[model samples]
Target: MPAEKISSLDDPRVYKFTLQKDKELARDQEIIVDSPKVVLRMMDAGRTPKAILANQKFLDDHGQRFEGMDCQVYWADVPLLEKIVGHRLHHGVIALAERPESLKLSALGHRLLVLNGVNKAENVGTIVRTCDALGVDSLLVDERTLSPFIRRAIRVSMGSIFRIKVRTSADLFSDLQTLRTSGYQVLGTGIAPDTHRFDKIDFAKKCALIIGSEGFGMDSALVGLCDAVIKIPMRDHVDSLNASVAAGILLQRLGAI
Candidate 1:
């Protein structure tokens, strides 16, 4: 369809583009993405937008992309666009798309990262982007954590969000058991002296690295479930590393990708 010019704040057609909390959007399995780059990356992942709102000038410069896609494309002046989105105007375009379907544990590769109640969006995003770069096959996140589809997380992932496979586990313990029985070594991150140092072990071909909440480390149950617990060797002065940084280090060492 041709670009529909948005003229007024009262326009019903552009209503979905109006802002809402990311949590609210996630409740409906929907996400509002900023900029043409993110939208383009999302499309490249074999997904289509439900609608796109672009500044008129932005559309003029890059209109070819919207030519035949199956979605609404609306352009408006900066002032009106700001009002519609309830924010300062920037980034030429924004798109609304549903979250990609979640994958099953059985469908993922041998190298996986399991997030147990990780609370920060930035941490999640950084870990995801690092996972994409290092060839970590997929991510398994427990439901207690923030959704990776949250807007802040999406922004931080820098388009890697669209490229990674993620599975949400309702029963993380049971799922870990299944993975362990399938010849996978479940590794836990911990600070205990007896925990195997990351460099000391021969990392398994099929391994799941479990990272727990930042404030509270892995709870007792999860630690007990793991076949082995591992720790990064660091100076005694530095107690712990940021979750994302640690993830990058471990994944690079694992070379499972």
Candidate 2:
């Protein structure tokens, strides 16, 4: 399609489409991907783009990527694009892409991450990127966990979210038990009386590492049912670590990557 020109940021369709809430993205099946790498990654993952909004420089440099795609390409001068997105552009590229369909728990792989109450999108994004890099098979998100498809999450993940299977479990407790029945050793990450050092755990078995929110940590009931609790031995006065950072350390040790 020929490139189109966006004349105004106040265009109703632009606001309606761009201002979607994180939760709405899954229902609407649409996402806004920023940066050239993330946009190109989304296309490579076989997700279709609804449209692409870029500055003239990007259009001139990379516009050929969209040559035969069934989507609109809108290019504007720098200032105009900044006005529309309400911020300085990131690598002068933004794309409106369709969200991938969610997978079921049965469809997820052997090694998994079951996020319990991990609500920060940025942290979730970092974890997703780590999982993709470390070869953690899939992600099973609880109801309270943030959606990995949000703009900030997708950007931070660098499109790694699209590379892994993601399934949302409506009931966190029940799903954890179900996984145990399915031959997965459910391990929760935390500091407790019974917490085992990272290397002490046998990672050779099928495992599902459960990560909790930064502030409150995992719920007591969920922690009690874990086959074993794992912790990273940190020095100094640090009692805890960021959810994503802790996940990366654990994944590196357990992921065998």
Locate the minimum summed-lDDT window of 10 residues in model 1: 19-28
Question: Candidate 2: which stretches are off by over 4 Å?
Answer: 23-26
The C-alpha local distance difference test score for the whole of candidate 2 amounts to 0.83
Best candidate according to lDDT: 1
Clashing pairs in 1: none
Off by over 4 Å in 1: none
lDDT to native, each model: 0.84, 0.83
* Model 1: per-residue Cα lDDT over 22-88, one tens digit each: 7667777888887767778888888888888999777887778777879888889999998998887
lDDT per residue as tens, model 2, 1-257? 98988788776545523554655666678888899899888888888689888888788888888899898888777887887877888689888877776787788888888888898888999999999999886999887888888899999999998898998888888888888888988888888757899787786467888899999888888976789888888885889999999889888865772
Model 2 clashing-pair count: 0
Estimated TM-score per prediction? 0.93, 0.93
